[model samples]
Target: MAQHHKKIYPDVEIAMPTRPRASLGLENGDPSPIRWCHQASPSLSLIPSPSQTPIQTLNLNPRRCCCKCLCWTVGLLTLLLFIVGATAGIIYLVFQPKPLNFDMTLSARFNVRITTDNPNKKIGIYYEKGSRLSVWYKDTNLCQGTIPKFYQGRQNKTVLNVALTGRNRYGTTLLNALQEQQQTGRVPLDLNKNVPVSVKLGALKLRKVRILGTCMLIADSLTTNSLISIKASSCHFGLKL
Candidate 1:
Protein backbone atom coordinates (compact mmCIF):
# COMPACT_ATOMS: atom_id res chain seq x y z
CA MET A 1 0.00 0.00 0.00
CA ALA A 2 2.96 2.49 0.54
CA GLN A 3 4.60 1.78 -2.99
CA HIS A 4 1.37 2.50 -4.93
CA HIS A 5 1.03 5.90 -3.29
CA LYS A 6 4.59 7.05 -4.39
CA LYS A 7 4.31 5.93 -8.08
CA ILE A 8 1.10 7.89 -8.60
CA TYR A 9 2.79 11.21 -7.52
CA PRO A 10 5.53 11.14 -10.34
CA ASP A 11 4.23 11.83 -14.14
CA VAL A 12 5.80 9.92 -17.06
CA GLU A 13 7.66 12.13 -20.00
CA ILE A 14 6.64 11.64 -23.89
CA ALA A 15 9.22 11.46 -26.98
CA MET A 16 8.80 13.95 -30.15
CA PRO A 17 10.13 13.76 -33.98
CA THR A 18 13.30 16.02 -34.79
CA ARG A 19 14.20 17.99 -38.16
CA PRO A 20 17.60 17.50 -40.25
CA ARG A 21 20.43 20.18 -39.93
CA ALA A 22 20.88 22.81 -42.86
CA SER A 23 24.28 22.65 -44.77
CA LEU A 24 24.98 26.49 -44.47
CA GLY A 25 24.94 26.85 -48.34
CA LEU A 26 28.44 25.33 -48.79
CA GLU A 27 29.94 22.43 -50.81
CA ASN A 28 33.43 20.82 -50.51
CA GLY A 29 35.95 23.65 -49.55
CA ASP A 30 33.85 26.45 -51.20
CA PRO A 31 31.51 28.59 -49.13
CA SER A 32 28.76 28.57 -51.87
CA PRO A 33 27.60 25.26 -53.41
CA ILE A 34 28.79 24.60 -57.00
CA ARG A 35 25.20 24.34 -58.26
CA TRP A 36 24.06 27.38 -56.25
CA CYS A 37 26.64 29.99 -57.44
CA HIS A 38 24.80 30.44 -60.72
CA GLN A 39 26.81 27.39 -61.92
CA ALA A 40 30.04 29.51 -61.75
CA SER A 41 28.76 32.11 -64.28
CA PRO A 42 27.53 29.21 -66.43
CA SER A 43 31.14 28.05 -66.90
CA LEU A 44 31.84 31.37 -68.70
CA SER A 45 29.28 30.27 -71.32
CA LEU A 46 31.94 28.75 -73.73
CA ILE A 47 29.36 29.16 -76.53
CA PRO A 48 30.89 31.11 -79.41
CA SER A 49 29.18 34.39 -80.43
CA PRO A 50 28.13 34.98 -84.04
CA SER A 51 31.31 35.96 -85.92
CA GLN A 52 31.48 38.75 -88.59
CA THR A 53 33.32 37.83 -91.80
CA PRO A 54 35.47 40.47 -93.63
CA ILE A 55 34.09 41.65 -96.98
CA GLN A 56 36.37 41.51 -100.08
CA THR A 57 36.65 44.63 -102.38
CA LEU A 58 37.01 44.54 -106.17
CA ASN A 59 39.81 46.51 -107.94
CA LEU A 60 39.99 47.69 -111.60
CA ASN A 61 43.25 47.47 -113.57
CA PRO A 62 44.47 50.78 -115.08
CA ARG A 63 45.61 49.25 -118.38
CA ARG A 64 42.18 47.79 -119.10
CA CYS A 65 40.45 51.11 -118.37
CA CYS A 66 42.71 53.03 -120.78
CA CYS A 67 42.13 50.56 -123.63
CA LYS A 68 38.38 50.95 -123.34
CA CYS A 69 38.70 54.74 -123.46
CA LEU A 70 40.88 54.62 -126.62
CA CYS A 71 38.39 52.47 -128.46
CA TRP A 72 35.56 54.96 -127.84
CA THR A 73 37.61 57.92 -129.11
CA VAL A 74 38.41 56.30 -132.50
CA GLY A 75 34.80 55.45 -133.17
CA LEU A 76 33.76 59.08 -132.61
CA LEU A 77 36.36 60.46 -135.09
CA THR A 78 35.33 58.16 -137.98
CA LEU A 79 31.73 59.32 -137.68
CA LEU A 80 32.76 62.97 -137.98
CA LEU A 81 34.71 62.53 -141.26
CA PHE A 82 31.79 60.80 -142.97
CA ILE A 83 29.46 63.67 -142.10
CA VAL A 84 31.83 66.32 -143.58
CA GLY A 85 32.22 64.57 -146.95
CA ALA A 86 28.46 64.47 -147.53
CA THR A 87 28.08 68.21 -146.78
CA ALA A 88 30.68 69.29 -149.37
CA GLY A 89 29.11 67.32 -152.23
CA ILE A 90 25.71 69.00 -151.72
CA ILE A 91 27.14 72.53 -152.02
CA TYR A 92 28.84 71.83 -155.37
CA LEU A 93 25.59 70.79 -157.05
CA VAL A 94 23.76 73.98 -156.11
CA PHE A 95 26.02 76.23 -158.22
CA GLN A 96 26.87 75.64 -161.89
CA PRO A 97 27.61 77.81 -165.01
CA LYS A 98 25.27 78.39 -167.98
CA PRO A 99 25.82 77.19 -171.56
CA LEU A 100 26.14 79.01 -174.97
CA ASN A 101 24.11 78.76 -178.22
CA PHE A 102 25.04 77.81 -181.86
CA ASP A 103 24.51 75.45 -184.86
CA MET A 104 26.83 72.56 -185.84
CA THR A 105 27.63 70.35 -188.89
CA LEU A 106 30.59 68.18 -189.95
CA SER A 107 31.87 67.02 -193.41
CA ALA A 108 35.00 65.62 -195.05
CA ARG A 109 36.47 64.96 -198.58
CA PHE A 110 39.60 63.57 -200.34
CA ASN A 111 41.50 64.52 -203.52
CA VAL A 112 44.15 62.45 -205.30
CA ARG A 113 45.71 61.52 -208.75
CA ILE A 114 47.84 58.52 -209.75
CA THR A 115 50.07 57.31 -212.71
CA THR A 116 51.31 53.84 -213.90
CA ASP A 117 54.91 54.26 -212.65
CA ASN A 118 53.46 56.24 -209.66
CA PRO A 119 50.95 53.64 -208.58
CA ASN A 120 47.70 55.16 -207.29
CA LYS A 121 47.75 54.92 -203.53
CA LYS A 122 44.62 54.64 -201.42
CA ILE A 123 43.72 57.15 -198.70
CA GLY A 124 41.90 56.34 -195.46
CA ILE A 125 39.94 59.03 -193.70
CA TYR A 126 38.62 58.73 -190.16
CA TYR A 127 36.47 61.56 -188.86
CA GLU A 128 34.00 62.27 -186.05
CA LYS A 129 31.88 65.37 -185.37
CA GLY A 130 31.09 66.93 -182.01
CA SER A 131 31.75 70.29 -180.32
CA ARG A 132 35.07 69.64 -182.05
CA LEU A 133 36.32 67.72 -185.12
CA SER A 134 38.57 64.68 -184.78
CA VAL A 135 40.19 63.63 -188.04
CA TRP A 136 42.73 60.89 -188.92
CA TYR A 137 44.18 60.17 -192.39
CA LYS A 138 46.61 57.51 -193.62
CA ASP A 139 47.95 56.39 -196.98
CA THR A 140 46.57 52.97 -197.82
CA ASN A 141 47.75 50.31 -200.34
CA LEU A 142 44.29 50.03 -201.93
CA CYS A 143 43.55 52.54 -204.72
CA GLN A 144 40.28 53.09 -206.64
CA GLY A 145 41.61 55.09 -209.64
CA THR A 146 44.10 53.99 -212.36
CA ILE A 147 47.53 55.58 -212.45
CA PRO A 148 48.08 58.31 -215.11
CA LYS A 149 51.10 58.04 -217.49
CA PHE A 150 52.03 61.78 -217.11
CA TYR A 151 52.77 61.19 -213.36
CA GLN A 152 54.26 57.75 -213.92
CA GLY A 153 57.85 58.76 -212.98
CA ARG A 154 56.83 61.60 -210.62
CA GLN A 155 55.77 61.53 -206.98
CA ASN A 156 52.01 61.39 -206.42
CA LYS A 157 50.22 64.23 -204.62
CA THR A 158 46.91 64.03 -202.67
CA VAL A 159 44.76 66.37 -200.65
CA LEU A 160 41.92 66.05 -198.11
CA ASN A 161 39.31 68.60 -196.98
CA VAL A 162 37.10 68.86 -193.94
CA ALA A 163 34.39 71.42 -193.27
CA LEU A 164 32.68 72.48 -190.04
CA THR A 165 29.57 74.73 -190.13
CA GLY A 166 28.10 76.50 -187.14
CA ARG A 167 26.88 79.96 -186.08
CA ASN A 168 29.78 82.32 -185.23
CA ARG A 169 30.54 82.95 -181.56
CA TYR A 170 32.91 85.90 -182.27
CA GLY A 171 34.40 85.41 -185.75
CA THR A 172 36.93 82.96 -184.30
CA THR A 173 36.29 80.84 -187.36
CA LEU A 174 37.76 83.58 -189.60
CA LEU A 175 41.32 82.75 -188.70
CA ASN A 176 40.80 79.03 -189.19
CA ALA A 177 39.02 79.69 -192.52
CA LEU A 178 41.85 81.90 -193.73
CA GLN A 179 44.44 79.34 -192.80
CA GLU A 180 42.44 76.66 -194.55
CA GLN A 181 42.08 78.80 -197.67
CA GLN A 182 45.85 79.29 -197.87
CA GLN A 183 46.69 75.65 -197.14
CA THR A 184 43.93 73.96 -199.11
CA GLY A 185 42.59 76.71 -201.42
CA ARG A 186 39.22 76.62 -199.57
CA VAL A 187 36.65 79.35 -198.97
CA PRO A 188 36.31 81.18 -195.61
CA LEU A 189 34.40 79.22 -192.99
CA ASP A 190 31.50 80.60 -190.87
CA LEU A 191 32.07 78.00 -188.14
CA ASN A 192 33.31 78.66 -184.61
CA LYS A 193 36.84 77.29 -184.74
CA ASN A 194 37.55 78.00 -181.07
CA VAL A 195 34.45 76.17 -179.95
CA PRO A 196 34.84 72.49 -179.15
CA VAL A 197 32.92 70.27 -181.57
CA SER A 198 30.77 67.75 -179.75
CA VAL A 199 29.13 64.51 -180.90
CA LYS A 200 25.75 65.73 -179.68
CA LEU A 201 24.41 68.86 -181.41
CA GLY A 202 24.62 72.21 -179.53
CA ALA A 203 27.01 70.72 -176.95
CA LEU A 204 30.02 72.92 -177.91
CA LYS A 205 32.86 74.25 -175.63
CA LEU A 206 32.11 71.17 -173.53
CA ARG A 207 33.08 68.78 -176.35
CA LYS A 208 36.37 66.87 -176.46
CA VAL A 209 38.29 65.66 -179.54
CA ARG A 210 41.24 63.29 -179.89
CA ILE A 211 43.06 62.36 -183.17
CA LEU A 212 45.78 59.77 -183.60
CA GLY A 213 47.11 60.70 -187.09
CA THR A 214 47.87 63.96 -189.00
CA CYS A 215 45.66 63.48 -192.10
CA MET A 216 43.21 66.26 -191.13
CA LEU A 217 42.59 69.13 -193.58
CA ILE A 218 40.27 72.14 -193.21
CA ALA A 219 39.13 73.28 -196.70
CA ASP A 220 38.28 77.02 -196.74
CA SER A 221 36.73 76.45 -200.17
CA LEU A 222 34.04 74.20 -198.73
CA THR A 223 33.12 76.53 -195.80
CA THR A 224 30.42 79.26 -195.96
CA ASN A 225 31.45 82.90 -195.45
CA SER A 226 28.01 84.19 -194.36
CA LEU A 227 27.17 84.35 -190.64
CA ILE A 228 24.30 82.06 -189.66
CA SER A 229 22.02 82.33 -186.64
CA ILE A 230 20.85 79.28 -184.79
CA LYS A 231 19.15 78.41 -181.46
CA ALA A 232 21.05 76.21 -179.07
CA SER A 233 21.76 75.66 -175.38
CA SER A 234 25.55 75.39 -175.85
CA CYS A 235 28.21 74.83 -178.54
CA HIS A 236 31.68 73.25 -178.52
CA PHE A 237 34.26 72.65 -181.24
CA GLY A 238 37.49 70.65 -181.03
CA LEU A 239 40.00 69.56 -183.78
CA LYS A 240 42.41 66.64 -183.62
CA LEU A 241 44.27 66.22 -186.91
Candidate 2:
Protein backbone atom coordinates (compact mmCIF):
# COMPACT_ATOMS: atom_id res chain seq x y z
CA MET A 1 0.00 0.00 0.00
CA ALA A 2 1.36 3.27 -0.71
CA GLN A 3 1.42 5.67 1.86
CA HIS A 4 -1.47 8.11 1.24
CA HIS A 5 -1.14 11.86 2.04
CA LYS A 6 -4.01 13.49 3.71
CA LYS A 7 -4.96 17.03 2.19
CA ILE A 8 -6.10 19.70 4.55
CA TYR A 9 -8.84 22.29 3.30
CA PRO A 10 -9.12 25.93 4.66
CA ASP A 11 -12.24 26.79 6.64
CA VAL A 12 -14.95 28.94 4.58
CA GLU A 13 -17.10 31.56 6.22
CA ILE A 14 -20.73 30.86 6.39
CA ALA A 15 -22.01 34.65 6.51
CA MET A 16 -22.23 37.31 3.55
CA PRO A 17 -19.48 40.03 3.21
CA THR A 18 -20.32 43.60 4.25
CA ARG A 19 -19.32 46.93 2.09
CA PRO A 20 -16.97 49.56 3.73
CA ARG A 21 -18.67 52.95 4.80
CA ALA A 22 -17.22 56.60 4.21
CA SER A 23 -17.54 59.24 7.10
CA LEU A 24 -18.96 62.78 6.00
CA GLY A 25 -18.51 64.34 9.47
CA LEU A 26 -15.54 65.17 11.67
CA GLU A 27 -14.38 62.74 14.12
CA ASN A 28 -16.16 64.63 16.94
CA GLY A 29 -19.43 64.33 15.02
CA ASP A 30 -19.96 68.18 14.40
CA PRO A 31 -22.35 69.52 11.65
CA SER A 32 -21.39 68.55 8.16
CA PRO A 33 -18.48 70.60 6.71
CA ILE A 34 -19.26 73.53 4.25
CA ARG A 35 -17.96 73.14 0.72
CA TRP A 36 -15.66 75.94 -0.56
CA CYS A 37 -16.19 77.20 -4.19
CA HIS A 38 -14.27 80.06 -6.03
CA GLN A 39 -16.31 82.44 -8.47
CA ALA A 40 -15.14 85.76 -10.12
CA SER A 41 -17.17 88.93 -9.25
CA PRO A 42 -18.84 90.57 -12.32
CA SER A 43 -16.36 93.12 -13.86
CA LEU A 44 -17.54 96.85 -13.87
CA SER A 45 -15.88 100.10 -15.43
CA LEU A 46 -15.22 103.21 -13.17
CA ILE A 47 -15.63 105.76 -16.07
CA PRO A 48 -18.27 108.46 -15.34
CA SER A 49 -21.63 107.86 -17.03
CA PRO A 50 -22.19 109.93 -20.14
CA SER A 51 -23.17 113.47 -19.04
CA GLN A 52 -26.79 114.27 -19.84
CA THR A 53 -26.94 116.02 -23.22
CA PRO A 54 -27.37 119.81 -22.66
CA ILE A 55 -30.90 120.85 -23.42
CA GLN A 56 -31.09 122.84 -26.72
CA THR A 57 -32.50 126.38 -26.25
CA LEU A 58 -34.55 128.22 -28.93
CA ASN A 59 -33.59 131.93 -29.36
CA LEU A 60 -36.24 134.68 -29.83
CA ASN A 61 -35.72 138.52 -30.18
CA PRO A 62 -39.00 140.38 -29.42
CA ARG A 63 -37.40 143.85 -29.72
CA ARG A 64 -36.24 143.24 -33.30
CA CYS A 65 -39.65 141.94 -34.39
CA CYS A 66 -41.43 144.88 -32.74
CA CYS A 67 -39.09 147.39 -34.39
CA LYS A 68 -39.71 145.92 -37.84
CA CYS A 69 -43.48 145.97 -37.28
CA LEU A 70 -43.44 149.56 -36.07
CA CYS A 71 -41.46 150.75 -39.07
CA TRP A 72 -43.88 149.04 -41.49
CA THR A 73 -46.91 150.48 -39.69
CA VAL A 74 -45.55 154.04 -39.84
CA GLY A 75 -44.74 153.68 -43.53
CA LEU A 76 -48.24 152.43 -44.29
CA LEU A 77 -49.86 155.30 -42.36
CA THR A 78 -47.81 157.92 -44.19
CA LEU A 79 -48.75 156.44 -47.57
CA LEU A 80 -52.44 156.50 -46.69
CA LEU A 81 -52.24 160.14 -45.58
CA PHE A 82 -50.55 161.15 -48.81
CA ILE A 83 -53.24 159.44 -50.85
CA VAL A 84 -55.99 161.24 -48.94
CA GLY A 85 -54.35 164.61 -49.39
CA ALA A 86 -53.95 164.06 -53.13
CA THR A 87 -57.57 163.02 -53.48
CA ALA A 88 -58.81 166.09 -51.61
CA GLY A 89 -56.73 168.42 -53.79
CA ILE A 90 -58.11 166.87 -56.96
CA ILE A 91 -61.67 167.22 -55.70
CA TYR A 92 -61.19 170.88 -54.85
CA LEU A 93 -59.84 171.62 -58.31
CA VAL A 94 -62.69 169.76 -60.03
CA PHE A 95 -65.47 171.51 -58.09
CA GLN A 96 -64.11 175.04 -58.26
CA PRO A 97 -66.08 177.67 -60.27
CA LYS A 98 -64.82 179.22 -63.49
CA PRO A 99 -64.20 182.98 -63.83
CA LEU A 100 -66.02 185.21 -66.32
CA ASN A 101 -64.53 187.71 -68.85
CA PHE A 102 -66.65 190.69 -69.95
CA ASP A 103 -66.36 192.80 -73.12
CA MET A 104 -68.07 196.18 -73.82
CA THR A 105 -68.29 198.72 -76.70
CA LEU A 106 -66.21 201.92 -76.28
CA SER A 107 -67.81 204.41 -78.74
CA ALA A 108 -71.26 205.37 -80.04
CA ARG A 109 -73.51 208.48 -80.99
CA PHE A 110 -76.97 210.10 -80.51
CA ASN A 111 -78.97 213.31 -81.42
CA VAL A 112 -80.16 215.98 -78.98
CA ARG A 113 -81.85 219.49 -78.82
CA ILE A 114 -82.12 222.71 -76.71
CA THR A 115 -84.53 225.83 -76.31
CA THR A 116 -84.98 229.12 -74.40
CA ASP A 117 -87.75 231.75 -73.61
CA ASN A 118 -86.38 235.28 -72.71
CA PRO A 119 -86.14 237.58 -75.82
CA ASN A 120 -83.64 240.07 -74.38
CA LYS A 121 -81.71 237.48 -72.26
CA LYS A 122 -78.05 236.87 -73.03
CA ILE A 123 -77.50 233.12 -73.24
CA GLY A 124 -74.37 231.45 -71.97
CA ILE A 125 -73.78 227.85 -73.00
CA TYR A 126 -71.47 225.58 -70.96
CA TYR A 127 -70.41 221.95 -71.26
CA GLU A 128 -68.04 219.59 -69.53
CA LYS A 129 -64.79 221.60 -69.16
CA GLY A 130 -62.72 218.84 -70.72
CA SER A 131 -65.28 217.76 -73.35
CA ARG A 132 -65.45 219.10 -76.94
CA LEU A 133 -68.54 219.85 -78.99
CA SER A 134 -69.30 218.33 -82.41
CA VAL A 135 -67.52 219.90 -85.42
CA TRP A 136 -70.78 221.36 -86.87
CA TYR A 137 -71.97 222.88 -83.56
CA LYS A 138 -71.42 226.60 -82.69
CA ASP A 139 -72.47 229.21 -80.11
CA THR A 140 -73.41 232.91 -80.81
CA ASN A 141 -74.18 235.95 -78.63
CA LEU A 142 -77.13 238.16 -79.67
CA CYS A 143 -76.87 241.00 -77.09
CA GLN A 144 -74.92 242.11 -74.01
CA GLY A 145 -78.00 242.06 -71.74
CA THR A 146 -78.76 239.30 -69.24
CA ILE A 147 -81.76 238.27 -71.37
CA PRO A 148 -81.55 236.72 -74.84
CA LYS A 149 -82.34 238.81 -78.01
CA PHE A 150 -85.73 238.23 -79.57
CA TYR A 151 -88.74 240.15 -80.92
CA GLN A 152 -92.17 240.32 -79.24
CA GLY A 153 -94.74 239.21 -81.72
CA ARG A 154 -98.44 240.28 -81.87
CA GLN A 155 -98.96 237.72 -78.99
CA ASN A 156 -96.82 240.09 -76.84
CA LYS A 157 -94.48 237.26 -75.79
CA THR A 158 -90.73 237.10 -76.30
CA VAL A 159 -89.53 234.39 -78.75
CA LEU A 160 -85.84 233.38 -78.61
CA ASN A 161 -84.47 231.53 -81.63
CA VAL A 162 -81.63 229.11 -81.14
CA ALA A 163 -80.18 226.26 -83.17
CA LEU A 164 -78.72 223.13 -81.49
CA THR A 165 -76.55 220.43 -83.07
CA GLY A 166 -75.65 217.00 -81.77
CA ARG A 167 -73.16 214.74 -83.53
CA ASN A 168 -70.46 212.47 -82.07
CA ARG A 169 -70.01 209.18 -80.27
CA TYR A 170 -72.93 209.18 -77.84
CA GLY A 171 -71.05 207.41 -75.05
CA THR A 172 -68.38 210.10 -74.62
CA THR A 173 -70.61 213.13 -75.30
CA LEU A 174 -73.71 212.02 -73.39
CA LEU A 175 -71.94 210.89 -70.22
CA ASN A 176 -69.75 214.00 -70.08
CA ALA A 177 -72.57 216.40 -71.09
CA LEU A 178 -75.05 214.91 -68.63
CA GLN A 179 -72.53 215.10 -65.77
CA GLU A 180 -71.74 218.72 -66.64
CA GLN A 181 -75.40 219.67 -67.15
CA GLN A 182 -76.18 218.34 -63.68
CA GLN A 183 -73.66 220.87 -62.34
CA THR A 184 -75.38 223.88 -64.05
CA GLY A 185 -78.97 225.13 -63.86
CA ARG A 186 -80.62 226.20 -67.14
CA VAL A 187 -83.28 225.19 -69.66
CA PRO A 188 -82.50 223.32 -72.89
CA LEU A 189 -84.30 224.45 -76.14
CA ASP A 190 -86.36 222.64 -78.74
CA LEU A 191 -85.98 222.66 -82.54
CA ASN A 192 -88.59 224.52 -84.63
CA LYS A 193 -90.91 222.75 -87.11
CA ASN A 194 -89.14 224.43 -90.05
CA VAL A 195 -85.82 222.80 -89.06
CA PRO A 196 -85.34 219.08 -89.59
CA VAL A 197 -85.16 217.67 -86.07
CA SER A 198 -83.79 214.31 -84.97
CA VAL A 199 -84.00 213.51 -81.27
CA LYS A 200 -81.95 210.81 -79.66
CA LEU A 201 -82.23 210.04 -75.97
CA GLY A 202 -81.53 207.16 -73.65
CA ALA A 203 -83.93 204.45 -74.86
CA LEU A 204 -83.96 203.25 -71.28
CA LYS A 205 -84.65 206.79 -70.07
CA LEU A 206 -87.46 207.35 -72.63
CA ARG A 207 -89.55 204.52 -71.28
CA LYS A 208 -89.10 206.17 -67.92
CA VAL A 209 -89.82 209.71 -69.16
CA ARG A 210 -92.94 208.96 -71.26
CA ILE A 211 -92.99 212.61 -72.41
CA LEU A 212 -94.63 213.85 -75.62
CA GLY A 213 -91.97 214.45 -78.27
CA THR A 214 -93.32 217.90 -79.40
CA CYS A 215 -94.00 219.18 -75.89
CA MET A 216 -92.16 219.16 -72.51
CA LEU A 217 -95.43 217.96 -70.96
CA ILE A 218 -95.64 214.42 -69.45
CA ALA A 219 -98.14 211.96 -70.88
CA ASP A 220 -100.59 210.79 -68.23
CA SER A 221 -100.88 207.37 -69.94
CA LEU A 222 -97.27 206.41 -69.20
CA THR A 223 -96.24 203.94 -66.44
CA THR A 224 -92.89 205.42 -65.35
CA ASN A 225 -91.89 209.04 -64.48
CA SER A 226 -88.27 208.36 -63.53
CA LEU A 227 -86.97 209.90 -66.76
CA ILE A 228 -88.86 213.16 -66.17
CA SER A 229 -87.10 213.59 -62.86
CA ILE A 230 -83.73 212.62 -64.40
CA LYS A 231 -84.15 215.13 -67.25
CA ALA A 232 -85.48 217.99 -65.11
CA SER A 233 -82.92 217.59 -62.31
CA SER A 234 -79.84 216.27 -64.14
CA CYS A 235 -79.69 218.31 -67.39
CA HIS A 236 -79.20 222.05 -68.23
CA PHE A 237 -78.35 224.41 -71.17
CA GLY A 238 -77.34 227.99 -71.86
CA LEU A 239 -76.27 230.28 -74.73
CA LYS A 240 -72.66 231.52 -75.07
CA LEU A 241 -72.36 235.27 -75.69
Q: Each candidate's lDDT (Cα)? A: 0.37, 0.37
For candidate 1, the 10 contiguous residues with the lowest summed lDDT are 140-149
Instruction: Go through the candidates in order and give the clash count of each.
Output: 32, 22
Candidate 2 residues 115-174, lDDT tens each? 433233332221111222221111321111122222222223333323323333433544
User: Which 10 consecutive residues of model 2 have the lowest summed lDDT?
Assistant: 204-213
Off by over 4 Å in 1: 1-33, 36-58, 96-241
Query: Against the hidden reference, what TM-scores do the models get?
Result: 0.19, 0.18
- After superposition, candidate 2 runs with Cα above 4 Å error: 1-57, 97-241
lDDT of 2 at 108: 23
Q: Write the per-residue lDDT of candidate 1 for residues 165-226, one digit (tens) a residue.
A: 22323334444544454564433222222222223222222344552222233333333444
